[model samples]
Target chain A: MYKGYVVDKALLDKDPHFKAGCILCHAGNDGELSKEKAHLRMLKKPSDNLRSCGVCHKKTAANYAKSLHYTTIGQRTGVMPRFSEAELKTFDEKVFEKSCRSCHASCGDCHVKGAPVGGISIGLVAKHKFVKKDEGKTCAFCHGGRVYPEYTGDYGGAPDVHYQKGMLCMDCHKKAEFHGDGTAYKSKNEVPQRPACKSCHPQGKEAKKETQVAHSLHDGKVSCYGCHSGSAYRNCNDCHGGHAAAGPGMILGRSPRDRKVLTTLRLIPTVRDTFAPAGIKMEHFDAVPNYWDTPAHNIKKRTERTRKCDVCHVDRKNFLTKETLIKNGAKANEELIFVPKAIAR
Target chain B: MKNRRTFLLAFLAVWILALYGAAVFAATPNKCIQCHTNDALMKSLHKPPVLPKSEGEG
Candidate 1:
């Protein structure tokens, strides 16, 4: 590192203390650079490595714990019962050489200032040429056909390029915003200054004012989840719900037709059901101490918690604006919102 | 009868040890104060560092 061999001379002068060497992220110092010693570094468990980096990103690691990645491992007591360790070890030997570069892709490779053969150039970044077949390759490794399914009869799935070619998970999965143990609190407004939805749909305000364009426009009311994630929309269901949000939104026995009336599924405190309401059924909108004990965060009871609406009377301030409202046609006032931060990010 | 009672006690001890091992092993909460007491965790999880009220809202 002191020799400052391939590192840019100008860049090094600017940031003198920059630890620019393999030893920073990897192990084995003596400059031997043996393949066996490099692989020995893998013996250090992921959790231990996480502790080293957790100091820099305290909040992000906590949220990652609650996410699907950690949750899957946690549920099985850190064991994949279906696949034996021996079988996986054998499979690793057969297919690993061809697949390792793609499936277990790391951030170090992508974010490195300048790499060789696959350096951080605009062309390489644009095409995501780092991993030959990136998304399908990584997701399918652990997640079966349901995810990046190469099988037939998996009809209602998005085309692979959406996850593969498009802005992949790394683009949006905010670092230092998740916990290692895997529990993401809803309080984290990704863009507290702005919002998440408006990032992709900047002209959403104009869209909300029109009947045809606005997804929120239902019979006469707005499906807030279609806009701000209310009702059936809960947690991180907005983007990941490629299929109909079948997790929390699965109403006990209600059929399709009954959905409209039973739409407001209040999380009324209940005995731990055999299936749903696995743990404590705390209200969605947790109390902001000293403010009020109003039950917020529930699908059916959000607007009442967040905003005062002209549900019965005409909001004279918004007649010209609220004209687009399908249900509250009488309401003269209305406002629209989206995840506004994506624009700035 | 004496032998059966001794066996039962040994089994109970093993069972209790296993349960405690699982619970404590799963939730390993370490304190950063070991090396650096001043960290963001202290701010987020620790009691607020504000002066106690004296008289009232003066």
Candidate 2:
């Protein structure tokens, strides 16, 4: 390793980037042989600035600038629908920048260095060599806490069939979604390239006729994860104050975006004093549950609810209600409590 | 005494040469503009997004 950066022989000998030399990307004095002087203004991650990557990949950089990964607009918009106009302005200017923005992925954060999340920065993603993508170290490094673990069955549930079949995030989520198609969408829902369960599993393609009929009953109303997600998933609470005060749990509720849809509800770490640093306190702290319409990654082809029709249809106890919520702050999440309606089928 | 003086001068010359050799023989120019000034390279270097500009002191 040269000064903590592993010198990849292949990259040094073959890659154009290495041929261009280190000083081209990492700025500093090449004339000085002293380590300190050579690294005076060296950029550990040059790709953090679009200019570094844009020189060769202009179109991708242009589209990526507007992508959700860059702007984190989807996360910003998710909370917008819950707050008032006055609160939103303060949130945009203060709370978001202080608390949420750091977690948002930058281009270099993925393709070059490890993401800086919760103030923890891992080593370089690929030892200063620019990579197109490395899902394990790059994507999982940030998403490791919840999504990655659940996808791999590390969270005590059966792994997603897709993951078992060796499908990476890039497999389902195409390049357009990552680099963006030049549309500034407010949420992932608004993106035209957003992945849907229906996209891969179309009607009557592989599913049985009975399964199609059952899906149709709740078409456009419920997400497939509502019933198909078999195991308990992450629903964090009280993040601003204490880190240990949170753990994963399952909760069901009406989708915040679509009221009629009963979907899997995960409590985002937005609490009363969530933005106390910015001097903004959420007024309706307990008025509504901070349940966002979450796409729970833990999915099973056959689940408790899908094992048989009557398990969900007749079992009122299993449904989300005051009795079923096990966590401490769950009672406050009144809005997301699933209610049973008469099934016409 | 003459031999000692010759040894000292030789050591000094070697030290200076070792320090300056790598920089002088570097394949790429030490100047930033030498490579960055290339139109093809510069054109590809696109401008970054206008992120929320704040004091970041918050």
Best by TM-score: 2
- List-wise, what DockQ does each model earn? 0.01, 0.04
Error of 2 at A134 (Å): 1.3
Candidate 2 docking DockQ: 0.04
Tens-place lDDT per residue, model 1, A305-337, is: 124323212332211122322231111112221
lDDT of candidate 2 over A1-345, digit per residue (tens): 111134444555567876666778887886765556777998867877777788998998888888888888877776665566787889988877866676667677777677755444555666556777788877887787778778888877778878889888888888889889988888888888878888888856755877877788767766898878868776665556454244657666788677788888776776666566766666545555567777888887888776665665666434567765545453356656766664557
* Candidate 1 structure lDDT: 0.29
Q: Stretches of candidate 2 above 4 Å error?
A: A1-4, A81-86, A284-288, A323-333, A342-345, B1-58
User: Second chain only: TM-score per model?
Assistant: 0.48, 0.42
Best by lDDT: 2
Which regions of candidate 1 fall more than 4 Å away from where they truly are? A1-48, A55-144, A147-167, A170-345, B1-58
Interface RMSD of each: 24.0, 13.0
